[model samples]
Structures are given as structure tokens and as C-alpha cells.
Target chain A: MQPVEHPKSLNEVTADKIRNAIVEGELALGAKLSEQRLADLLGVSRSPVRDALAALQAEGLVVISPKRGSFVFTPDSHVVDELCEHRVILETAAVRLGITRNPSELTRQLAASCDAMQSALDAGDPHGYTRADHQFHNAIIESADNRALAKSYVLMISPLKALRTHLFTIMTENTDRSLSEHHLVLNAVRDKDPDRAISLLSAHVGHLAEAFRANLSTSQDGKISPATLEA
Target chain B: MQPVEHPKSLNEVTADKIRNAIVEGELALGAKLSEQRLADLLGVSRSPVRDALAALQAEGLVVISPKRGSFVFTPDSHVVDELCEHRVILETAAVRLGITRNPSELTRQLAASCDAMQSALDAGDPHGYTRADHQFHNAIIESADNRALAKSYVLMISPLKALRTHLFTIMTENTDRSLSEHHLVLNAVRDKDPDRAISLLSAHVGHLAEAFRANLSTSQDGKISPATLEA
Candidate 1:
């Protein structure tokens, strides 16, 4: 028999709410998070909000300082580059394992996720598109059927989704290119071409770093200066 | 200048202490943990112990049930297989990145770690050897110079180490083979041969799974039965 699920504690629920807000870009990058404000907004007590922030900090989605207060993570070009490189390593492994162990499932899931992305893009729904995009990549990780790998992916994926949201909304990155890349990778998966799928995925992830670097170099306001990115 | 480090909170310290205890096999696998007893032993209040267990639970080093108390993670054959596969993926990526980005540093750190492991084996210190083994693998991850990847590796390393300790003490798995495998991988790394290093490391990790499976099949007590390995 399937085990019964326990109801999430208030702290867990609060953490999920704040995590979604950050990943969905409702909470702006590097925005200060006031415990009282969050509690008021979420209709919860300060204790749960405080616990949630602490939990989110552990997840790398929030930053807490003793003197300065908590803030959403802000990734600069260097952070973006490292994150992209890490994503490429993980997703490529996921693709290889998925194809080796469960090619049919991976292909089916990718096709479904790809269709969702197309629908979101056609509807001009950035939120929906981003969610679909998240699921599309997650399909590859999930198809590997390794909980350890999936847990690791989940830890890093939020910041990536948040960054994608930032790129989509602020940078206004071309969704059409992303959609096309997804289709190409999906087609390669369908063809059972691990090398082609991995190469395409690597390039696709690399483009985000390139875009971030290009944007950073051209910006005059020093919003995401290289100095801030250090460590 | 390096950023000043903040002192770890009571919860963080408690978590680290408990984590080490588990990883070192001082705390037996599947042994129930009492917050009160832990707090007393650690000379702290129960609150910190409670918080620490929650944190450890998040790290996959501890399991907390609504009815049953927290326990150190106990990996069965299937769990060992999945963990080994996950390690192979992450460490191979680390090997490639280390060879590409920081070969000299990787070689230096690995040689030192290998020497330490050899000394530990010569001295017949299982704990020291396991610690050195941990560092040897960590050197590869650190050389990759990717904090995101390193963080993911840290999350999964504890349970793996605990299993290694178990193998050493209970299963009495041959340490010589593990050491020779480490040296083989190190030699490949020193030669800057990413492909060879990764292949050797993959096989080395795969052996851990094979050992766990072999031991599980021979045990008549059902201590770590396949049923317990499920999720």
C-alpha cells in the first residue's frame, strides 16, 4: 500500500510559498525580505515566515545576513556562468541516463512539455512559458529515475528558474529561439541520439551565460557589476 | 580581502556534530534519535537538537517520521546502487572539469590525499582512511571550481561515507582494492586524461554498489533487506 502523506507543517508551507514567489519572480531579485512584511502578506505569523526564510537560505534561494537582513539571491555574470556550466554538466548526465534507462518515457514527457511551452509562447504567457520550460528540463532529470540526482537538481533549479524569469522579463530574451532549441533537443531524444541531444542542450544552456555576459558588458548602470558577482 | 566568517549558530553546530557522528558511524544506521538525549550529550538544549534534526532531514542524512523519531539514513542495496550511480555522474563531471580547469591543483591535492590514504591503510586506521578517501574525492570536486556542483556533492557525500564506514567495519570489504582504484584514477588525473580518470572513478564507485548487493544477498538476518531499500 502507498504510504499516507503527512500534512506539511506551517513552516514548510510558508517555505513553499516564498520559494514559488522567488522562483516565479514575484519576489524581485536581491529584494530585502522583511519577516513582518512576509508574515503580513502571507497571513501567517512571523515565526513561520522567519523559519521559511532560514529554510530558503539553506536552499540557496534566499540570503540571510546577521546585520543586513535577508534578500533574494542576485546572480551576476560570473554566478550565471558557473550556474550555466553546472546546469550543462547535470542536464547532459540526466539526458544520457534518461536515454539509456527510459528513452520512451523521456521522449513522451519531452513532447508533452514541449507542446505546453509552445502553447504558452503562442498565448504570450510568460509565466506559463517559464513554468513549461522548467517542466521540460525537469522531464529529463526525472526520467533518469534517480532520486539523489533529482534532489540535487531541485536544489539548484530554483535559482535557474528565477534567472530565466529575470532574463525573460528584464532582458526580454527571445522565446522563439528557446522553443526551437527545445524542439531540436526533443527530436534528438526521439531519435535516441544522446550525443546530439547533450550537445544541443549544452549549447542551449550556454546561450544564457552568453546573453548575461553580453548584457552585463553593455549596461552602464552597474546593476549587476562584476565586483558584486564575486563569491 | 576575504569576507569575515560568521560564527555558526547553535543549530548549525548541532547539525554538524550529528552529521559527523552519522558519517563516522558513531551513530548507527537506522538507530532512533532522541532529541533530549542528543541535547544532553551535546550539552545543549533540546531546541537546537530539534532544529538540527530538521536540517539533517533536509540533507537526506536523517529521516523523521510523524510517529517514529528521527534516525540516521540506512541505505539498502538499491539505495546504494542509486547513490553510486549518482556519485558516478557527479564525480565524472568533476574529473573532467578538474582536468580541464585546474589540472595541476587537482594533481597536487589528489597526490596528498592519496598519500594520506596510504598512510591510514598502513596504520590500519579505518576512520583516518575513510576521511582521507573523502578528501581525495573532494579534491576533484573542488578543482572543478564550481560552488553549485560542490554544494550538491556535499549533500550526498555524508550518507555515502556512512555506508563506507559500515562496509569497513561490518562487511570488512577489502580496502586494498579501493586504494588501488584511487591510485589508478589519480594517475589518470595526473596524466590529464579526463576520459581515463572518469572511467576508473566510475568503476571504483560501481564496486561499492556491487559490494553492498553481495553483502545484502548473503545476510540471513534481513538486516538490510531489499524491501527496506525501497524509497
Candidate 2:
């Protein structure tokens, strides 16, 4: 049996709240983070907020500079490309491992997650769709039953998710295409085609980088600006 | 041009010192870590040591328990298996990326590192040999030029290195075999055969896990004991 998990400390809870804000696009990319403002907003002292920022910095979701203060992470084109390559390497390996180790469970989770994505798309809920999208990939990682891989995935995934949220919400990128890509991957997995599933998943992840690059090129400032993109 | 790197902070320095102790086997695996003891040993205060332990815990080098206190991580068979699998995935991907991106540079560094390992082995210097072994693999990861992949590789490599030190110093596992494996991988990379290089690397990393299991079964206790293994 699995050991009982310890409860999250206040610091962890604060970090999670800030992480969700960033990943869900409630906190804009590259926006300055004021500890005092955050502490006031969260109705806590500055200490927990400080700790939370430090924790988030390690996760690549927040950037803290001693002289310049803290801000949400901003991804350059190079960073986006590298992050996508890293994701493909990890997720493809996870897909192969998942299929080999636990095919039935992996297929079940993928199907369920795909159904959730379909419902979210039908209801036009971007947030729900993104969450289910994460679950679909997460199922593959979890099915691999390698804690180290899952931990590494969690560490690197936040920036990608934050970028996805930005693309979906502010830039209003086409969600239908992403949904269909997920379906293709799911079908391949259910049909026991690991190679096809992996290749389709790679292409699917590559599209996020493409979408980010397209937006970056079209933006007035040649950078991701919430104001310009939303307008 | 690359930006200047910031100097290490006190917390970071403290963490690095402690991390070296663990990774170098100066601090044995599963050894209890008292903040006061460590601070006294390092001639600092307890706060930084506490912070360092937290950081090391994040890297999977140290385990912090609320009730039991902090201890150096001890790997069971399952953890060893999972970690080996994780290493295979990351290193194999790094090998391919390195070969594709900069074959000449990768080949040059691998050859240099192999020479260093050979010299260390000839001199009967286990520590030097281990350091060279690390440099050989690090060359591959660095050659990939993906900061995300390199960061993940750094995080997971410490424990494996520590175990390797244990196998070498305590169990007296044959270094000749490991040296030969590295040579085979280097030759494959030099010959521009990524498939052959990756397969050789996969087998080479798998041997570490096999060595650990071999030692564990021969130990008097079911667990890894420094004294028991030393004898």
C-alpha cells in the first residue's frame, strides 16, 4: 500500500495558488509580481508569498531577480523550441513505456481524458479543455509507473502549459485542431500502435511551438503581449 | 553573447557543499543529517544548512522527513530500476541529439573524457575515474544544447553517481568492464552510428543496476549497509 501523503504546508499551498494563476493565464506572462500586492491579495503575510515565489522559480514558472524583483517567466522563441523538444523526448518515451507496461489501463485513461476534452470543446470551455488535455498526456506518464519520469515531466510542464493557456485564451488559437490531434493519438494508442501514437504525439506537441512562433511573429512588439494579443 | 552568470549565494554554496558530500560518498547513504552537526562541520549556522537540505531534497539527493528528520537517500531495488530507466531515456535522447547537432564536438569530448578515465584507471584512482566517467556522460548532455534536458539530467544524476561510488569503493565492482563500455559507446559515436551508440549506452547504464542488485543480495542484511558492505 502507498504511504499516507503529508499535508501541504502553507508555503506549498501558496505556491500552488500562484502556480495555478500563472498556468491558467490569470497571471500574465512576463508581468511583474509584487510580494506585497500578492500578500494583500491572498490575505497573508509577505513571508509565505516570498517562499512561494522562490519555489515557483525552481519550477520554471516564476523568475526572481534580486535587483529587479520577481515576474512570471517569459519564453523566447529558442526557449519554446527547446521546451518542445524536451517534451517530445519525454512524452514519447512515456508513451512507449506506458503501452508496454500497462496497455489496458493506459488505453482506458486516454479514452476517458479524450471524452473530457470533447465535452469541454463542445461546451467551449477553454480552461476545461486545457485541463483535460493535460490529463490525457499525464495518463501516459503515470501509466509508465516511473516516478522519476513523472517528476521530471511535472518540473518541465508548467511553462508549456502556461504558454498553451496564453495561446488558447488571448490569441484564441483554434482548439478544434488540438482536439482532433488528441483523438488521433488516442485512436492509435487504443489500436496498440505505439509508433503511430508516439509520432502523432510528437507532431501534436510540435504544433504548440509553431503556434507560439506564429503569434510571436505577428505581435506588434515582436513579443507576447497580453494587451496587444487580446486586442 | 551569453549573459553573465550571477555569483552563488550563501544558500547555494551551502547546498553545493552538502551535495558534494552526498554525491562523493563522504556522507553515506541513508545517514541521518543533523542541521547542528552539519553547520558545525561546515562552520556556518543552521539556517543555511536547513535551506540546503530542502534544496537537495528537491534534487532527490536527500530525503527530508517531518518526524524522522533529513537523511541521505537510500535506493531500493524498485527505485534503482526506475532511476536506471529514467537515465536510459534521458541519456539516449541526449546521445542522439548530440550526434545530430554536433557530431564532431561530441566525438572530440567523448574521446577526451575516455582518455581521462583511462589515465585515472591506470593510476588506480577511483575518485578520478568516477569524475571522468561523469564528464564523459555530461559531454553528451551538454552537446545537446538543451538547457531543460541538461537541468533534468543534473537533478537525477547525483544519486546514481553516489551508488556508483558505493559499488566501486565498497563492493569493488570491476572498473575495467565500465571503461570498456564507455569505449564502445565512444567508438559508435565516432563512427556516426547513433543506433549502435544508443544501444551500447543502454546496456552500459543497465549494468549499474545489475551491480547494485548483486551487492544487495550478497550483503548480510537485506538493506545496504556501509559497514556490512565494506567488510
| Winning candidate number (TM-score) | 2
Which portions of model 1 miss their true places by more than 4 Å?
A: A1-5, A216-231, B1-5, B217-231
RMSD of each: 5.4, 4.1
* Full-model lDDT for every candidate: 0.81, 0.84
True contacts kept of 2: 0.66
Q: After the best TM-score superposition of candidate 2, give how far the Cα of residue B43 lies from its true spot, in angstroms.
A: 3.0
TM-scores for every candidate against the unseen true structure: 0.90, 0.91
Model 1 iRMS: 1.2
Q: Which residue pairs show backbone clashes in model 2?
A: none
TM-score of 1: 0.90
Residue B117 displacement (Å), model 2: 1.0
Chain A of model 2, TM-score against the native? 0.88
Question: For residues B1-231, what per-residue lDDT tens digits would candidate 2 score against the true structure?
Answer: 779878887778889888877766677778888888788877789878887888798889899887678998876778878888999999999999998999999999999999999999889887788889899999999989999999889888888887776555653777889999999999999988999999999999898789877775565222334231110
TM-score of chain B of 1: 0.88
**TM-score (chain A) of candidate 1?**
0.87
Please provide, for model 1 over A1-231, each residue's C-alpha lDDT reduced to its tens digit, 9 standing for 90 to 100: 879877998888889889878776677778888888788878889888887887788778899886678988877777767778888888999999899999999999999999999999878787788778889999999988889888888887778777665555653677889899999999999999999999999999888678767765565222331111110
